[model samples]
Target: MTLYGLKTCDTCRKALKSLDKVEFRDIRSDGIPPDVLKSAYAALGDELVNRRSTTWRGLSHDARAADPLTLLAEHPTLMKRPLITDGTRFFLGWGKDVQADLMR
Candidate 1:
């Protein structure tokens, strides 16, 4: 399994600590793989973009209006935190539902 998120993200840290033998890819440094990003978008849809992030707030209205996939590709930090994939399915965020799915 692989966890794609920022190294500075606390939520990512928590998830990383909780998951054993999982690879942590800091999006800022390693950059998300194209295939993985596409798979994540397919599963999470528009919800993949983090509308609540500081990066989102800074984007112009036109930028926000652009295609979600384009926005995500241009600004990776705009992606929601801790997009965990077990190579088969995707789990976005570290919410209870996601925890229940991944913790096992």
Candidate 2:
């Protein structure tokens, strides 16, 4: 499994600590692959974008208004935490539903 997230994010840290056999990618350093981002956007839709993030809060209205996919590509940290995938299925966030799916 590959986990895409920020290394400094507490939630990401928590998720990383709990998972086994996972490859962690720090989006700040290594950007998400466009195909994976596209697939994640397809699977999670608007939920894939994190509007509550500090990066999101700092974005100008104009930037925020851009297409979500475009915005995400430009600012990878704007994506929600720990987007986990196995090159097929995607799981966003470390929520109960996602944990349930991945832990199984």
Candidate 3:
């Protein structure tokens, strides 16, 4: 199982702490390698970018209107943190519901 997220993310930390065999990969520290980013977009399409994030919201209207690929290439933080993925399964955020799904 592999987890893609930032170490500073509390939810990511919590999820990691709950697991004993996770192959943790800090996307922020390691940086979202182009291949992984490409796969993320391939797996979820444009939805990979989360407009609800504060990072996205902080963008100006013009910036917010930018294309997803452009946004992802320029500002990946807008794509939600703690994007935990267990190869086949992918979780967008940290919460009991998501945790339950991932833990399964």
Best by lDDT: 2
Quote model 2's TM-score. Answer: 0.94
lDDT of 1 by residue, 1-104 (tens): 99999999999999999998999988888878888888889888988999998999999998899998888888999999999999999999999999998887
State the lDDT of candidate 2 residue by residue for 1-104, as single tens digits. 99999889898898899899999999999998999999999998999999998899999999999999999999999998889998899988899988888887
Q: Among these predicted structures, which one has the highest TM-score?
A: 1
Cα deviation in Å at residue 99, candidate 2? Answer: 1.2
lDDT of 3 at 88: 68
**lDDT measured at residue 92 in model 1 versus the true structure, 0 to 100:** 90
Lowest-sum lDDT 10-residue window in model 1: 29-38
Residue pairs in candidate 1 whose N, alpha carbon or C atoms collide under 3 angstroms:
none
Which model, 2 or 3, shows the larger lDDT? Answer: 2
State which candidate, 1 or 3, has the greater TM-score.
1
- Show where candidate 3 strays beyond 4 Å: 45-47
Any idea how many clashes model 1 has?
A: 0
Give the C-alpha miss distance for residue 66 in model 1, angstroms: 1.1
Window of ten residues with lowest summed lDDT in model 3: 26-35
Give the Å error, residue 30, model 2. 0.4
Note the residue pairs that clash in candidate 3. Answer: none
